[model samples]
Target: MTQTASMSQNGARGLVRGGALDVLRFVAALFIVLYHVAERAPVSLFALHPALSRGYLGTDFFLMLSGYVLARTYGERVLSGGVGTGEFLKRRMLRIWPAHLVMLVVFVAFVLGTAAIGLAPQNPQWFQWSQLLPQVFLVQAWFVPGISGWNMPTWTLSALIVCYAGFPAAWRLTAKVRSPWTTLAVGVAIFLAVDYAALAATGIPGHQLPLRFGLVRGIPLFVLGMLVARMPTTIPSRLADGLAIAAGLGVFALQALGRFDHASLALLSLLIYAAGASGAKGSAWASLAGRLSFSLFLTNQLVAVVWFGAQRAAAARFGFDATMLWLTWALALPACVAGAWLFERLVDTPLQAWIKRWSRREAAVPAPASEPIAA
Candidate 1:
């Protein structure tokens, strides 16, 4: 095959670009936000009442996508000595932490400001200093359990950091496996075992493993995504595109039914595979939205709280009915979108550029002059 053909088939690599996966990222992030709307709403909307009830699964999709994209973008470089582990980690940290820290500070200020004004947060437990350590260090999901303390959605970032730390080793090990399919199968089995174990132990998956065991919840699927990345993307484009459609439908159907956890994951895997294999270039808007998705996901809790706070302050007279819930959701959704866009442009974009420039300067800096006496 020609080089261009190969590149198209394999999909673009790196965080800034991918093969239609950015669109998937946008969709997945939106799904989670809508899910949160249903959960936090005084009453759920008729339109969102069905599939969104299980929308927390969107985070599961994000975890897998992260693994897949990282492996595709950096795995070969790390394995081939093109990128050092230190640099790889530095880049990952630069990608996430600057934006994350900004949001963390904002979240903290919101809590403190509200408390000072005699308006204790509705979820005061998350505002405690106990969560500060984990949140600051991005280890909440690993060290702490149940909730992500300051920002509820950020636990995923904590778990992702863990995965990023381990990915070099994991990628190298999986590369040696004779059959990537077998590795994926084993991963799926392990995931099922853990899921069932959680189900049996708790009698319900309700806020059990996913909320508390971020490491356990994340690692297997992450490994599965890496394994998937190893497969040749030369599958016929038409077939892959068709499979993508089918997988999307399957995801919606399973979500609506709200049963069979593994099936949902399987469909997600198929979606990723199809997206990678179909040779579709992501649209500009999709790419921009995907880039903003991190901001969107991380800042949502704060925005929602701010919306509710405003409502309370205004004495808007909310009620336990669809109208009030929809109204709050409507206001909150736009705030999240605008906040995400602004955070991406003002905070994340500039900070990332500065970090990259700093890294380059550090690399360019001359080591201390060798001591003449030693020479």
Candidate 2:
């Protein structure tokens, strides 16, 4: 079958939902949680498994995946004017904003509660009140100082919002290039140029760009995702399967070797493309995990904050042994995962339903008739 026929036969199944990518998303979220947990734990998981140290790469994967998924879902509609820019952004904002606001409030309460009880955080600078406004407004990642304050992971969300704002233009640009190969080449070139420029300007790779300028790090990868989404899936399923396996192994190998080359990022992109092209309908468990991935990403930091804080307080008061600390550290991972599941069901799901209902009600209400103009 032709690429178009394959996609149609599958009902664009991989792009729409239920695919290996969902499982990958959950795994990425898990690694992100592991990354943060390792940061705060007395015994670092990174020490035992060096590859765990590279978990920040999960954010890069997420940004790229967001581009691919959004393009697949809305690119055509957006380009053809079936979805207005305002409406698209509004929906995207609504999807993320409620959970973010709730998490922000939770962080604020945690900070205030700890302060009231005279329990100071180990890193007080991370909870600066001065940075709260920018975070609240979701512009913390846009050249703002202290962008890493409050909920540090939310920096990705801030960067993602900026990407979403520019998505229509990015999609149009991607589509305007008639040849998929040319589009792919240009996207790769732009990403490499930016990556190297970042390396030259700041000793950090573009993917590791500072949180304060996360938009710079996010846009190129996101556009790369859009470009990948627009490419024809002409490779056979068996070849796509081989590509997926190879790319997945390459990513792990690079991480294990402590190599932070652009190849890992390229491998991640390839892994996503292969998974999509293979057209495997994902299992229900994978779908559920995928649904919880956003919550997992957003809430893990908060979980770390609370878990570590309480561990510190308890240890100081009781003079707990290393064994107790280590045990609690192990438990932190599950706590983070469970916290994410609860937050999604109790807070995000309900708020999203309410927002949809409110939107429908607003749409149903007819506009008031214009008053007659004075002569």
The most accurate candidate by TM-score is 2
* lDDT (Cα, tens digit) per residue for candidate 2, span 35-137: 8788666767777877777776899999998888787778767878877777788889988988899999998998898889888888888888889998898
Candidate 1: C-alpha lDDT: 0.74
Q: Please give the lDDT score for candidate 2.
A: 0.82
* Candidate 1, RMSD to the unseen true structure: 4.4
Tens digits of lDDT, candidate 1, 1-375: 001223522354223353477888888887788777665565555355565566656888888888887887777677787776666777788788778888989988988888898988877777878778788888877847545577878778878787888888877787788887877777777777776776787665522365547777777777778777877776777888899999999988876776666778788988998887776654669668777788898788888789877766654553436566567567787788888898888888888889879978986766667733211
Q: Alpha carbon lDDT of residue 197, candidate 2?
A: 93
Off by over 4 Å in 2: 1-16, 46-50, 368-375
Q: How many residue pairs clash in each candidate?
A: 0, 1
| Model 1 / residue 363 / CA error / Å | 0.7
